[model samples]
Target: MKKKNIIITGTSRGIGYELVSLCTDAGHNVLALSRDAAPVSGLDIDNCACFSCDITDKRDVAKVSEFIKEKWNHVDVLINNSGYLVNKPFSKLKMSDFQDSYEVNVFGAVAMTQVVLPFMKKSSHVVNISSMGGVQGSAKFPGLAAYSSSKGAIITLTEVLAEEYKETGPSFNALALGAVQTEMLEEAFPGYKAPLSAKEMASYIMDFSLTGQNYYNGKILEVSASTP
Candidate 1:
């Protein structure tokens, strides 16, 4: 496989971090984005570039866009992996929680996509990291309204963009992830058993992005330990 230029968001830790590692190991040039400090020791920065930017901030995202344009000129794959979650009962959920969740999961992803599209060449791939909770309503969890709703919007956005860009080159898909042992999942189901690890989830996402199958465009590629 050809080494592609890949940009993955929310790479401070969890699935995004694992994705960065897998992409780098596969010889792809990786551009990692996060608001937190850079990776301390584990990752190889030789072929990987880390950028500190808050995805929720449009200005920060734009700055990263400029940097990418100046450095790589074009990106081959874009993975929107940033997400936010606040767990509580519906009655206890605050309006601020919903606002924060949407800002990161929906608007932030959209903004980053908008900025990167201009610099993305033909045949580029865009993967949105959504959750299975977004696909089916969960009666078991009450406080997931904000998080799940935002992810649902991400799925819809993926569909709309896929249709809108059908004539264009970039293919768009949403990965409706199940219970992965990521920080977000831990926050969602505190003390609950995790069904999959971040490494496992990242492996699937990376493979899907590289294959360019286009079969899953505008559809959700649900992943779980049981599904694979």
Candidate 2:
């Protein structure tokens, strides 16, 4: 496969960082965005560019869009991976928490997609990262009202975008990740056992993004080690 220009959000750590590494290793030009602004070691910085921007902030997301326009003019794939979670019982959860979660998980992804769509070619793909909690509500785990709702919103958004853009050329899909060993999961379930690693999840994500198949568009691709 030829080296394609790819942009991913929330690459400071976790699955986003792993995606950057794997994509670069596969000979794709990667542009990563995060709020932390730290660089990942080992990847060639020349071929891979990292930018610091809070996706929740429309102004900051616009700056990233402008940067991409000036730098590459187009992108072959876009991964909306930035997200936040606040695990608190629905009654105890503050309005601010809900707002913040939606701002990052839903609106942020929408903003970046709006900006990047114009620059994407006909074969471009857009992947939104969600969670298994979004697919099925968990009575077992307590205090996930805000986080789960935000992820649920993403899944719906993916479906809406896919239908809206059906004739527009680019494919849209959502990935409902299950128990990955990431900082977010560690924070949610401290010392909890996870079945998959970031690297493992990243490999599947990259394949879905670059394969040029429409099987996943408008559908939720669940990722889990034990899942068949």
Candidate 3:
């Protein structure tokens, strides 16, 4: 496997954290971005370095972009794994919820792509981590309207960006994932039994993040354990 320079957002915990673990273990150089101001406690891998940056903040994103340029000068893969979920029924959902969700789920990805595109080599892979709830006709949850909509936007953006950059390079794809046994999942659905663990999902994420451009550019790949 080619050792690549990878950047993953929201690497403080959950699947994002697992991705950092997998990448570092595989001897890949990783720039793990987290909203937390400090590096994840006890995460001391030589190949991995942690940076504090909230995806919603353009200045923070810019600094990260600058840091990447100064260090590796280019990225081989970028995994947009940061997400937000403000679960509330449509009637009770506030406008701020929609804005906040979009900021992280949609705009954050866009911002990262735009800032990093210049530093990304040709054929670089971009994996947009979306939720199954964003998929049309999928099983809907009661209080995930804003979260779902933001993710749905990610799918569209992935498709359009992939097509638009067909000749330019940097393949883009979105994985609409089912419930994973993550802290976020438990918070959203208390005591739910999710079929996939964070490390399991992280394994798939590593595969798609590195190699999916070969077979799945501009597509919304739904990853679920449920059988239709």
lDDT of 2 by residue, 1-228 (tens): 988999999888899999998998888899889998676534556678876888878888888778787788889999999889787788899999999999999989999999899998767899999988788543235688888888999999999988988887588888888788889888977897788888888888999889734565688877756542
Report the CA-based lDDT of candidate 3 relative to the real structure.
Answer: 0.88
Per-prediction TM-score to the true structure, in the order listed? 0.93, 0.93, 0.96
Please give the range of 10 consecutive residues that has the lowest summed lDDT in model 1: 36-45
Tens digit per residue, CA lDDT, model 1, 91-177? 898889999999999999999999999877658999999988787543224678898889889999999998998887688999888
Q: Which residue runs of candidate 2 sit more than 4 Å off their true CA positions?
A: 41-44, 136-140, 226-228
Cα lDDT of model 2 overall? 0.84
* lDDT of candidate 1 at residue 160, scale 0 to 100: 95
lDDT (0-100) at residue 153 of candidate 3? 94
lDDT of each: 0.84, 0.84, 0.88
